[model samples]
Target: MNKLISVVAVVVGTAAALPASAQITSGSIAQNKAECQAQFRVSDLNGDNFLTPREISLFRGSMPTELSGREVIHRQDFISACYATLPQDD
Candidate 1:
Protein backbone atom coordinates (compact mmCIF):
# COMPACT_ATOMS: atom_id res chain seq x y z
CA MET A 1 0.00 0.00 0.00
CA ASN A 2 2.81 2.46 0.88
CA LYS A 3 4.70 1.65 -2.35
CA LEU A 4 1.57 2.24 -4.43
CA ILE A 5 0.97 5.59 -2.71
CA SER A 6 4.54 6.69 -3.39
CA VAL A 7 4.23 5.82 -7.09
CA VAL A 8 1.01 7.76 -7.42
CA ALA A 9 2.52 10.78 -5.62
CA VAL A 10 5.52 10.79 -7.95
CA VAL A 11 3.34 10.57 -11.05
CA VAL A 12 1.13 13.42 -9.87
CA GLY A 13 4.14 15.60 -9.04
CA THR A 14 5.68 15.04 -12.47
CA ALA A 15 2.45 15.87 -14.25
CA ALA A 16 2.02 19.07 -12.26
CA ALA A 17 5.53 20.27 -13.10
CA LEU A 18 5.27 19.84 -16.87
CA PRO A 19 3.31 23.01 -17.58
CA ALA A 20 5.63 25.15 -15.47
CA SER A 21 8.64 24.25 -17.62
CA ALA A 22 6.90 24.42 -21.01
CA GLN A 23 8.29 26.90 -23.59
CA ILE A 24 5.75 29.47 -24.72
CA THR A 25 5.61 30.58 -28.37
CA SER A 26 6.46 34.22 -29.08
CA GLY A 27 4.17 34.55 -32.10
CA SER A 28 3.79 33.53 -35.73
CA ILE A 29 6.60 34.46 -38.12
CA ALA A 30 4.44 36.99 -39.95
CA GLN A 31 3.43 38.70 -36.74
CA ASN A 32 6.99 38.81 -35.49
CA LYS A 33 8.22 40.17 -38.84
CA ALA A 34 5.67 42.95 -38.88
CA GLU A 35 6.49 43.96 -35.34
CA CYS A 36 10.21 43.87 -35.98
CA GLN A 37 9.87 45.99 -39.11
CA ALA A 38 7.85 48.62 -37.31
CA GLN A 39 10.34 48.74 -34.49
CA PHE A 40 13.26 49.09 -36.87
CA ARG A 41 11.62 51.83 -38.90
CA VAL A 42 10.90 53.88 -35.82
CA SER A 43 14.42 53.43 -34.47
CA ASP A 44 16.24 54.20 -37.71
CA LEU A 45 16.19 57.96 -37.17
CA ASN A 46 18.92 58.88 -39.68
CA GLY A 47 17.01 57.43 -42.68
CA ASP A 48 19.94 55.09 -43.16
CA ASN A 49 19.45 51.46 -44.11
CA PHE A 50 21.33 50.28 -41.03
CA LEU A 51 21.19 51.14 -37.36
CA THR A 52 24.14 52.65 -35.54
CA PRO A 53 25.04 51.60 -32.04
CA ARG A 54 23.77 54.89 -30.65
CA GLU A 55 20.43 54.50 -32.43
CA ILE A 56 20.04 50.99 -31.09
CA SER A 57 20.80 52.15 -27.58
CA LEU A 58 18.22 54.92 -27.79
CA PHE A 59 15.56 52.57 -29.19
CA ARG A 60 15.97 49.82 -26.66
CA GLY A 61 17.02 50.82 -23.15
CA SER A 62 20.15 48.77 -23.71
CA MET A 63 21.30 46.32 -26.34
CA PRO A 64 21.32 42.64 -25.51
CA THR A 65 24.63 41.23 -24.29
CA GLU A 66 24.86 38.95 -27.31
CA LEU A 67 25.11 41.98 -29.61
CA SER A 68 27.84 43.69 -27.64
CA GLY A 69 30.43 43.42 -30.39
CA ARG A 70 28.25 44.55 -33.31
CA GLU A 71 29.15 47.95 -34.78
CA VAL A 72 26.13 48.18 -37.06
CA ILE A 73 22.78 46.39 -37.29
CA HIS A 74 21.20 45.57 -40.65
CA ARG A 75 17.42 45.34 -41.05
CA GLN A 76 17.27 41.55 -41.08
CA ASP A 77 19.60 41.21 -38.11
CA PHE A 78 17.59 43.74 -36.12
CA ILE A 79 14.36 41.94 -36.96
CA SER A 80 15.72 38.58 -35.90
CA ALA A 81 16.94 39.93 -32.58
CA CYS A 82 13.64 41.75 -31.97
CA TYR A 83 11.74 38.53 -32.59
CA ALA A 84 13.99 36.71 -30.15
CA THR A 85 13.19 39.22 -27.38
CA LEU A 86 9.42 39.04 -27.73
CA PRO A 87 7.53 38.11 -24.61
CA GLN A 88 6.46 34.49 -24.32
CA ASP A 89 2.76 33.83 -23.93
CA ASP A 90 1.63 32.53 -20.60
Candidate 2:
Protein backbone atom coordinates (compact mmCIF):
# COMPACT_ATOMS: atom_id res chain seq x y z
CA MET A 1 0.00 0.00 0.00
CA ASN A 2 1.04 3.63 -0.46
CA LYS A 3 0.99 4.27 3.27
CA LEU A 4 3.28 1.30 3.95
CA ILE A 5 5.65 2.45 1.21
CA SER A 6 5.72 5.96 2.67
CA VAL A 7 6.54 4.57 6.15
CA VAL A 8 9.36 2.46 4.76
CA ALA A 9 10.77 5.46 2.90
CA VAL A 10 10.73 7.58 6.05
CA VAL A 11 12.44 4.86 8.09
CA VAL A 12 15.11 4.46 5.45
CA GLY A 13 15.62 8.21 5.23
CA THR A 14 16.02 8.51 8.99
CA ALA A 15 18.50 5.67 9.13
CA ALA A 16 20.52 7.23 6.32
CA ALA A 17 20.61 10.57 8.09
CA LEU A 18 21.97 9.07 11.31
CA PRO A 19 25.69 8.93 11.89
CA ALA A 20 27.41 5.63 11.37
CA SER A 21 28.31 3.56 14.40
CA ALA A 22 31.93 3.79 15.47
CA GLN A 23 34.13 1.08 14.02
CA ILE A 24 36.33 -0.69 16.55
CA THR A 25 39.69 -1.92 15.32
CA SER A 26 42.98 -2.97 16.77
CA GLY A 27 45.57 -0.24 16.59
CA SER A 28 49.33 -0.36 16.13
CA ILE A 29 51.48 -1.72 18.94
CA ALA A 30 52.52 1.76 20.04
CA GLN A 31 48.95 2.98 20.10
CA ASN A 32 47.86 -0.07 22.03
CA LYS A 33 50.66 0.45 24.52
CA ALA A 34 49.68 4.07 25.10
CA GLU A 35 46.03 3.27 25.45
CA CYS A 36 46.82 0.47 27.86
CA GLN A 37 49.01 2.73 29.96
CA ALA A 38 46.27 5.36 30.10
CA GLN A 39 43.67 2.82 31.06
CA PHE A 40 45.96 1.37 33.69
CA ARG A 41 46.61 4.80 35.17
CA VAL A 42 42.93 5.56 35.39
CA SER A 43 42.10 2.19 36.90
CA ASP A 44 44.97 2.10 39.36
CA LEU A 45 42.99 3.37 42.33
CA ASN A 46 45.86 2.76 44.76
CA GLY A 47 48.44 4.44 42.51
CA ASP A 48 50.41 1.24 42.24
CA ASN A 49 52.13 0.47 38.94
CA PHE A 50 50.40 -2.89 38.63
CA LEU A 51 46.77 -4.03 38.58
CA THR A 52 45.46 -6.47 41.13
CA PRO A 53 42.50 -8.70 40.42
CA ARG A 54 40.30 -6.54 42.60
CA GLU A 55 41.31 -3.38 40.76
CA ILE A 56 40.55 -4.90 37.38
CA SER A 57 37.15 -6.01 38.59
CA LEU A 58 36.36 -2.47 39.67
CA PHE A 59 37.60 -0.99 36.40
CA ARG A 60 35.68 -3.26 34.03
CA GLY A 61 32.68 -4.04 36.29
CA SER A 62 33.72 -7.71 36.15
CA MET A 63 36.91 -9.61 35.51
CA PRO A 64 37.21 -10.71 31.91
CA THR A 65 36.85 -14.44 31.46
CA GLU A 66 40.26 -14.51 29.86
CA LEU A 67 41.77 -13.28 33.12
CA SER A 68 39.82 -15.58 35.34
CA GLY A 69 41.85 -17.17 38.17
CA ARG A 70 44.70 -14.75 37.62
CA GLU A 71 45.96 -12.81 40.60
CA VAL A 72 47.75 -9.99 38.82
CA ILE A 73 47.95 -8.57 35.28
CA HIS A 74 50.37 -6.17 33.68
CA ARG A 75 49.01 -3.19 31.78
CA GLN A 76 50.14 -4.39 28.36
CA ASP A 77 48.76 -7.86 28.84
CA PHE A 78 45.43 -6.58 30.05
CA ILE A 79 45.06 -4.24 27.11
CA SER A 80 45.99 -6.90 24.58
CA ALA A 81 43.51 -9.32 26.03
CA CYS A 82 40.76 -6.76 26.27
CA TYR A 83 41.28 -5.65 22.68
CA ALA A 84 41.26 -9.24 21.51
CA THR A 85 37.91 -9.81 23.20
CA LEU A 86 36.29 -6.84 21.43
CA PRO A 87 33.85 -7.85 18.71
CA GLN A 88 35.03 -7.00 15.21
CA ASP A 89 32.91 -4.33 13.55
CA ASP A 90 32.79 -6.17 10.27
Please write out the lDDT profile of model 1 over residues 9-72, one tens digit for every residue.
Answer: 6434533443432311222122344455655555565657787987665555433345557878
- Model 2: per-residue Cα lDDT over 1-90, one tens digit each: 996586456434543443343211123121333444444444554555667876665555423357666778776676676666555667
Which 10-residue span in candidate 1 carries the lowest summed lDDT? 21-30
State every prediction's TM-score relative to the real structure. Answer: 0.47, 0.44
- lDDT of candidate 1 vs native? 0.55
Q: Model 1 reaches what TM-score against the true structure?
A: 0.47
Question: What lDDT does candidate 2 reach at residue 56?
Answer: 60
Per-candidate clashes come to 0, 0
What lDDT does the true structure give each of the candidates? Answer: 0.55, 0.51
